[model samples]
Target: MADLKVNIGHLALKNPVMTASGTFGYGLEFADFIPLDGLGGFIVKGTTLKAREGNDYPRMAETPSGMLNCVGLQNKGVDYFCQHIYPQLKDINTNVIVNVSGSSPDDYAECASRIDALDNIPAIELNISCPNVKDGGMAFGVTCAGAESVVKAVRERYHKTLIVKLSPNVTNIADIARACEAQGADSVSLINTLMGMAIDIEKRRPVLSIGTGGLSGPAVKPVALRMVWQVARAVKIPVVGLGGIMNAHDAIEFLMAGATAIEIGTANFIDPSVTIKVRDGIDRWLDDHGCHSVREIIGCLD
Candidate 1:
C-alpha cells in the first residue's frame, strides 16, 4: 500500500484521516462502526475546565446539505475526560488529540495543561474557533490578537504538539493562521463550522433554539478548500483542513489544496464509516493513478 504517515509539528500520525472534534465523542463511540485505529488521530469532543450542560434541547438542526449546531460545547470537563475517558482509549493504536475549550485564556491554558499531563494524549487541539459558545470560543478565533493570545497562553502550559483550529468567519484566514504560527502553534486546522442560522419563516422564528448556530457540511467545502490553500501557502507550519469533506473526491481536493491531513466532520454524522471510506478511496485512487504513496498527492496544485 501507500505510505500515509504525516507529521503535525513533532508528532507523527500513521495516516492523514482523522475524525473531527465534536463529531467524534472520545474516540470510543465509533469503535464498532469504524476502526478507531485506522485513523491517524481524532479529536474528542470539546472538553472544558468545568462540565457544561450545553444549550437548549433543539441544539442540532438540519439544513440543505449541511448542519447547524449550537450544541454549546456540551462536554464533561477536562478532569472527567482525562481521568475517566482517556484510560479507556490509551490502548488504541492511533493518536488521541484532545479538543479543549474555555471561556477565558486562563481557562483554555488550564485545560491544555491538564490534558497535557496525560501520557497517552499526544496533542491538544486548542479550540479557539468553536462557534457554539456564548462568550469565548469563536470570539477568540475571529481576530489576530485574540487568536494569538489564546495560542500563546496555551503554548506556555501545554508542551505537546499544539494545533490551533481556526474560524472561517474571520476577515482574513491567512492573517489568523500566521498569528497562530507566530504564537508557537505547531499546526493549524481550519474552517471550524461557519456561523449560520436557520429560519422557521412560518412563525418568523429561528430553527435552532439558540438562534444562530454553526454551519458545517458539503455547503462549506469550497470555502474551506480556498481557506486551506491560502493558509497553507501562508504558513510553514502544517495545516489540517476540514469543511464538509464527505467523500474521496472531497478528500483529494483538500489534499491537493494543501491540507496535510483532514477531519471528517458532519459527514461522520451522515456516515460513520466516511473517514475509513475516504482513506480507502484515496488509496484506491492512488493505485489507479500509478501513484504508490498518498503523500505524493498532498499540496499538488499550483
Candidate 2:
C-alpha cells in the first residue's frame, strides 16, 4: 500500500483525505456509516461564539452539476461544542478540526481560545467564506487586509494548528494566501464554496431564499484546481484544497497541482463512503505508478 501520511504545520494526518465543513456536521453524525478515524481528519461544521438560527428557508439549492448553500455557519456556540461535542470525539483515533465562523475578530479569538484549550480538538479551520450569512464570514476572507487582520487576531489566542480557510471570490487568490501566511497561519484551506445562485424558471423566483449562495461540487473542480495550484505556490505552509473534488483522480489532480491535502465535500452527500474510496483509489494509483510515498506526488506537475 502507498503511504498517505501528510503534515499541516505541526499536525500530522494519517492521509490526505479530509471531509469539508458543514457537510460532515460534528464528525459524530457520520461515525456510524463512515469511519471518522480512518481518514486524515474530519472538519466539523462551522461553529460560532454563539448559537446561530441561520437564514430563512431555502438555504440549499441543487444546481445542474453542483449545489449551492447559504448555511450561514449555523451551529451551537463554542462552549456547547467543547462541552458536548468534543467529549464524544475524544474516543475516536483521529484529529477533529473544528470549523469556526464568527462576526468579529473578538468573536473569532474567543471561539479559538475555547477550542485551542481543549485536548481533543487538534486544529481549527476558520471559515472565511459562506455567502448565506448576515454577519462576518467570507466578507473578511475576500480581501488581503481583511484576511490578515482576522488571522492575526485568532493567531494571538489560538495556540494549536490554525488553518485559515479562504474564499475563491477574489482577484488574486495568491495574495490572500500570502496574507494569511504572514499573519501566522499554520496552513490554509482554499475554495470554501464559490458564490453562486440558481433560479427557478417555473416559479420565476430564486431557488434559495437568500437569493444567492455558495456553490460546490464537480462544476467548480477545474476552477478550484487552478486556485489551489496558485495558492500552493504562493504560501509556505500546506494548502488543503476543496471545491468539487469527487474521486481519487480528482484528489490526485489537486495533489499534483500543489495541494498537500484534499477535502471531499458534496461527493460525501452522494456517497457516504467516498472518502475511504478516495483513499483506496489513491493507494492503488500510487502503487501502479511505483510510488510508495504520497508526498512524491505533491507539486509534481512539471
Candidate 3:
C-alpha cells in the first residue's frame, strides 16, 4: 500500500479521510459499522459553551443530490463533553477532535480553553459559521473582521492544532481564511455547507423548520473544489477541504485541489463504512498510479 499519512499543522493523520462534524455524531455512534481507529480522525458533533436544544421538529430536508439542515449546533455543552464524552474517546487510539462553536469570540475562546485541558484531544476545529447572537445573528465567518476576532480569542487560549472551519456564505472566502491565519490559525477547512432552501409546494410551506439551511452532498462538490483551490493558493497555512466528498475519487479531487486532508460528511448517512472505503481506495489508486505517497497527488493539478 502507498504511504497515506498527512499532517494538519502538528497533528498527523494515518490517512486523509476524516468524518465531518455533525454527521458523524461523536464517532462512537458508528462503531458498529467501522472501527473507530481505522479513520484518520473523527470530529465530534458541534459543541458550545452551554447546552443547546437544537432546532424544532423538521430540521432536515432531503434535496436533489444533497440534503439541507439547520440543526443549530445541538449538543449537551462543553462541560458534558469534557466530563462524559472525553473519557470514552481518550483511549480510542486515533485523533479525537472537538468541533467548537459559539455566539461570540469569548464563548468560542472559553469553550476552546476547556477542550485544551483534555490531554487526548489533540485538535479543535473552530466553527466560525455559527450565528453571532451579539451581532444580530450574522455568522462570524462572513467577514474578515468577525473571523479574526474569534480566531484571535481562541488562539490566545487553545494552543494545540487550531483548524478554523470557514463558512461558504461569504463573498471572499480566501480573505476570511487569510484573516484566520493572521490570528494564528494552524489550519483552515473550507466550504462549510452553502446556504440553501427547500419549499413544499403541496403544503405551501417550507420543508424544514427553518426556511434556510446549509446544503451538503454531491451537489456541492464542484463549488467546494473551487473554493478549496482558491483558498489553498491564498493561504500559507494547511487547507482541509470538505463538501459532498462521497468516495475516493471525490476525495482525490480535493487533495489535488490543494487540500492536505478531506472530511466526509453527508456520505456517512448513506454508507456507514465510507470513510474506510475512501481510505483504502486512495491507497489502491496511489499504487495503481505509481505514486509512492498520497502527498504526490496533493496540489499536483495544473
Q: Who wins the TM-score comparison?
A: 3
Give the distance in Å from residue 184's predicted Cα in candidate 2 to where it truly belongs: 0.3
Q: Write the per-residue lDDT of candidate 1 for residues 51-121, one digit (tens) a residue.
A: 99999968888888899999989988888887889889899999999888888888899989998889989
What global local distance difference test value does model 2 have?
0.88
Error of 3 at 130 (Å): 0.8
lDDT of 3 by residue, 1-302 (tens): 99999999999999998989999998999999999999899999999999999998699999899999999898999999999999989999899999999999999999999999999999999999998889899999999999999999999999999999999998889899999999999999987989999999999998888888999999999999999999999999999999999999999999999999999999999999999999999999999999999999998888
The window of 10 residues in a row where model 2 has the poorest summed lDDT is 129-138
Scored by CA lDDT, what does every candidate get? 0.89, 0.88, 0.94
Off by over 4 Å in 3: none
True-structure RMSD, every candidate: 1.7, 1.8, 0.6
- Candidate 1: list runs displaced more than 4 Å: 130-138
TM-score of 3: 0.99
Best by lDDT: 3
**Residue 141 of candidate 2: its Cα lDDT?**
85
Give the CA lDDT, 0 to 100, for residue 83 in model 3: 98
